[model samples]
Target: METKEENFPNDSTMESIKSLTEKDAKTFLNLIYALIKDNENPSEQLISNVLTIFEKQLPRVAKARQNKN
Candidate 1:
């Protein structure tokens, strides 16, 4: 059986994502799952709102990555 690690090797996003608290991570994950599990694609504003929530939770992580570039 293929493990998740083998399925998604070299995931650079994980390093930045690890900065999120477990509760925040789970909340964001639930939001993503809700989007995918729906039949229709979400509206642009809905997507933007979800991204805004994520940014609020990880402002420092976002700023750090921006500074690195």
Candidate 2:
């Protein structure tokens, strides 16, 4: 069975993050902050899923930023 990380496209590039724009990034950050600040009790499965997404995707974003400097 394919995992969510495997199912997610590996074709993300710097262009994608760049396209997120300041406003979009701010909105996304706000949403994440709200979720964290609210003390929402996420299920283990939900936390696992989100962590998987972050592990798979955030490195690319970080790498892209690193390369930009």
Candidate 3:
């Protein structure tokens, strides 16, 4: 029997995550934890803040990758 692979919509986001430095990754994780810790359903503003954080990191990630080349 053959198995099929499933693709995630956020695969690119996952790839970007791999490029984060250890400290930044930890900060991101901590922020996510803090945002969701008390709320069963996170607010839209909270979600927006999370996206803003990730978007801010993308520039740094891209710069680091460029420097590596």
Report the number of clashing residue pairs per model: 0, 0, 0
Task: Tell me, by lDDT, which candidate is best.
Answer: 3
Model 2: per-residue lDDT, tens digit, 1-69? 768766453555434455555765675566556656765576655556555445555556556656776
Candidate 2: residue pairs that collide: none
TM-score of 2: 0.42
RMSD of 1: 8.2
Q: Which stretches of candidate 3 lie over 4 Å from their true place?
A: 1-12, 38-42, 61-69
Score every model by TM-score.
0.41, 0.42, 0.49
Residue 63: error of model 2 in Å? Answer: 21
- Model 3 C-alpha lDDT per residue in residues 1-69, reported as the tens digit of each score: 423432222555666777777886787788778877765555867766666666666556746765997
Q: Which residue pairs overlap in candidate 3's backbone?
A: none
Worst 10 residues of 2 by lDDT: 7-16
Report the lDDT of model 2 for residue 25.
64
Q: After superposition, how far is residue 55 of candidate 3 from its true place, in Å?
A: 2.5
Candidate 3 weakest lDDT stretch, 10 residues = 1-10
